[model samples]
Each structure stands twice: as C-alpha cells, then as structure tokens.
Target: MTTLAEGKAPVHLWVVGVLSLLWNGFGCYDYLMTELRNEAYMAQVPPQALAIFDAFPVWAIALWAIGVWLSMLGVILLLLRNRQATTAFLIAVVAVLASFFYQATTDLPQAMGGASYWIMPAVIIAVTIGQWMYANRMAAAGVLR
Candidate 1:
C-alpha cells in the first residue's frame, strides 16, 4: 500500500473531496426539499411521483434518509482524512441499495418509467459504490488515518 507523507494529503484527495461534497450536498438538499414539501420544489415534481414517494413504507423512507445523511457524512469524513469514512460509505451503499430495491418494487407512473428513471438510480449506485471503494483504497494506502 502506498503511504502518503505524514499529514499531507495528495491533490487528488482535495479534488475528490470537493466533488463528493457537492454531489452529496445536492442529495441532502433534494431529500430536505422533498421531505419538507417545499412548495416551489414540489411544484416541479410530478404529482404521480409525489404520490409514489408519499406511499413509501416507513422502512424504505428510513433507508433513504440513512443513505442520504450517511453519504454526506462519509464525504465530510473523507475530507477530514478519517479512516472511518470507509465504514460510513459502506453503510451508505447498503442503505442506498435497500432504498433502490424498495423503489424498484413499487409501481411507478409512466412518466417515471423512462430510461432516465432507471439510469439515475444506476448512476447513484455507481457513485455510492465508487465512494466506498475510493475511501477503502485511501484507508488501505494510509492516506486516511
């Protein structure tokens, strides 16, 4: 494993950290806006989609919240160069997968049944897993301590 200089984070760490913060920050924003029922934001969402969200099981919603919050926490921990980021990201991955599986089992409206709908979930999964793997690599390399 590659060992970084003591207390010196590589340039790539900053780049990934900033990008991850932005990405996960938006996720947190989306979650807050949706849960808060922000009129302006909710106005743009399809009613059918809203209905579907409203009907989500309590467990699924809990998983969704866990995924969003933990992912954001993972990004923060990553920026802090904490090895715990790996564990946080791992939990986020499982929460995201659970939430996604719940959504997939639900009946979605035609408007939400397009390629974009499926593609977004795939992208989320990819990014979530990527974050976990990246954190794991960094931890193993001694870049995170």
Candidate 2:
C-alpha cells in the first residue's frame, strides 16, 4: 500500500540524521581531544568567544559531550532500522537550532564575515530539518511500520 515517495522518506531522513550526528559528534571530539584543544587554537579565537565558553562550568561541558555522543548513538540506532532514533534526533535538532539562533543573532552580525565559514552550519541545519520532516512524514504514512 505504500507509495514510492513514502518509502524513500525514512531512508533519506536516516542518512541525513546520521550525517548530523557525525558533524556535531566530531566537533565535540575535536574540542575535547585534538590540536584544537591546544593554546594555539584558543589564542586565535576572539576573547569574547573564549569568555563565552569559559562562562559555562566544566560540568556543563561534560554534559554537552555526553549529549553529543548520545545523539551519535541515536543516529546509529536509527540507521540500524530503529525508528526511535527520531526522538533522539529531535533532541539533537533542538540543541543545534538553539546554537544556530544564538550564533546568528550574536556572533554573525558582529563578525567581518571572513571566509564565510558559517555556511557549513547553515547547510547542516537545512539538511537536519529536511531529514526530520521527511522522517516524520514517512512515519506518519506507516513507512516505518
């Protein structure tokens, strides 16, 4: 009884959802365990940005790390054919959207826009939203069932 479009939606959503998880999970890892953690990278960042990060306690960072990993795990589960990953993806999306809105409203308007690096985040957000919607529609159509 399923249409072609409906069957495809879940697949597309799972792919994008996996990508989103990898994107952020790696970022968390980069911050916690690589050259990015060194003073050199920290030195290059604007004082205000550094200050923003510093404002949050270490525990907050730990929780964020855990959240990132959980989202990645969710992606894996979803890709493994578990529709419950949709819920985890939604939580990840919420966190991502909040960060996106904060950065756009604050950091973006203040920057000189060098390299236009912000495009990466924008693209990721677009892909994530698209995936979420696609999955929701497919699930509603009983594609996951």
Candidate 3:
C-alpha cells in the first residue's frame, strides 16, 4: 500500500545510513589512534605499515584526518535524514580520493609489506562513493529532508 508520492522513507535508507555510520565510526577511531600514536594499536601494526605511517608528512596527515572526519560527519548527517549529507559525502569522497592517491602514488605503497595494504583504502573509497550516491538518491526521492 506504500506509494512513492507519500514520501515515506524506504527501509534501505535506514540500513545504509546505519551501516555507513558504523563504518565511518571505526574509521574515525582508527585515525584517532594512529594520530595519537597509541602504543598498543601501533604495536599491533606491521612494521612496514608502521614505517609508512611514520613517514607521512604533516600535510599528508592533515589530508588523512580531513578525509576521516568528513566521512564521519557525512554518516551522521545521513542518519539524521538531512539533505546536507549528500554534500558532506561528496566532499568526503573527494578528500578520500586525494588521500588514497597520495598513498598510492607516493612511496607508501611499496613501503607496505604487500598488496593487502591497498585493499582497505580501496574499500573505504568505494563505500564513501556508495554512501554519497545513496544519499543523493534519497534526497531526490524526498526521503531525506
């Protein structure tokens, strides 16, 4: 009995929003821990990866922080059903892409122990883009105000 004209929020909106929130929440935690140089967390990181982290210049570290914080904000906006989530996510995608490009094009990739280092970044970028697209769709559908 549901109709598109009713402007009812689809179930998928909540699902995607919640999932994006969780993913971005973890991202924020990881970024904070790395930035703080949490010994326990860094201890668990592979030496090669730790080396790459240690080598990040100030600007690179800033870019990384921007990317993570924006994505986290985007997810919060999404869960709030705000139209601003689309903008937040779009900018986040760009920020993430910049960070990923810097990591891949710089010496960082080779510094990584293996191909596995690329996987997480790839997934993060993909999910950020997906979240952006989902938010835009919801906005167009009037599911997000």
Candidate 4:
C-alpha cells in the first residue's frame, strides 16, 4: 500500500503534490522548449533575451538542467510519498541558487530587461523553498516513507 495509506493523508498532501507536478511540469516544458530552440517559442522571445539563453555557458546550462529536472523529480517523489523528496528538493534549491548566482553576476540580468526581469525567478525561488519545507514537514510527520 502507498505510504499515504498508513494514515489518512492530509488534504494538503494531494493538493500540493498535484500542484507541484503541474508547476514543475511547466518548468520542464520551458526548459525543453528553450533547449530545443523551438522556432515558434524562440520567436516569441525578444532577440536580446534569447541571446542570454543562447549564450549560456556549459556549466550554467548544466546547472539549469539540474534545477529544473531535480525539481520535477521532487514533485514525483512527493506524490509517491517518498522521503527522498526532501533531499531532491534541497538539491534542486541549491542548483537554482547556483544558476541564479551566475545570472545575477552576468550581463543577462540587464539584457533580459533589468529589475523587472527578476520577478519570475523570485517566484520560482519562493515556491521551491516552500516545497522543500513542505517535504521536510511531511517526512517528519511520517506521511512520507
């Protein structure tokens, strides 16, 4: 039986799990679309903004992939009621921090549009942190096995 069956899973567990899946799923879509250079999607990006992505160094690209993919994996682990979700979320947060540091230290911020460019990243950071905290709480409560 699912670990969730040990006791009735809190409503928030299902709610957060499904929501995390949907949220991170979109992030995966964004990552794939950009990595694949999907013409229509790429075309929608302003040339200067696109250049920032195109100019990503190998390490930065790898970190970005780690951040996105790990977060996606965290969502799956969360849904499965696995304690590993906490570790996955933590790793994803670290990857995100590294990637964000690279962007903040580079010209990408200014090129992507200035102060306004940080909105999405800020939201992502907050949600990721929230997910990590949630996972830790779930594990401690024995909701995850």
Ranking by lDDT: 1, 4, 3, 2
Give the lowest summed-lDDT range of ten residues in model 2.
105-114
Each model's total of backbone clashes: 0, 0, 0, 0
TM-score of each: 0.95, 0.56, 0.88, 0.93
**Against the true structure, candidate 1 has what lDDT?**
0.92
Cα miss at 71, model 1 (Å)?
Answer: 0.5
Q: On residues 28-96, what C-alpha lDDT tens digit does candidate 4 reach at each position?
A: 999999999999988899888877887889999999999999999998998888889999999999999
* Local distance difference test scores for all models: 0.92, 0.58, 0.82, 0.90
Task: Give the per-residue lDDT of model 1 (tens digit) for 1-145.
Answer: 4458366898899999999999999999999999999999999998899899899888998999999999999999999999999999999999999999988888899889887899989999999999999999999888898
Segments of candidate 4 deviating more than 4 angstroms: 1-5, 109-113
Span of 10 residues, lowest total lDDT, candidate 4:
107-116
Cα miss at 32, model 4 (Å)?
Answer: 0.2
Give residue 108's lDDT in candidate 2 (0 to 100). 38
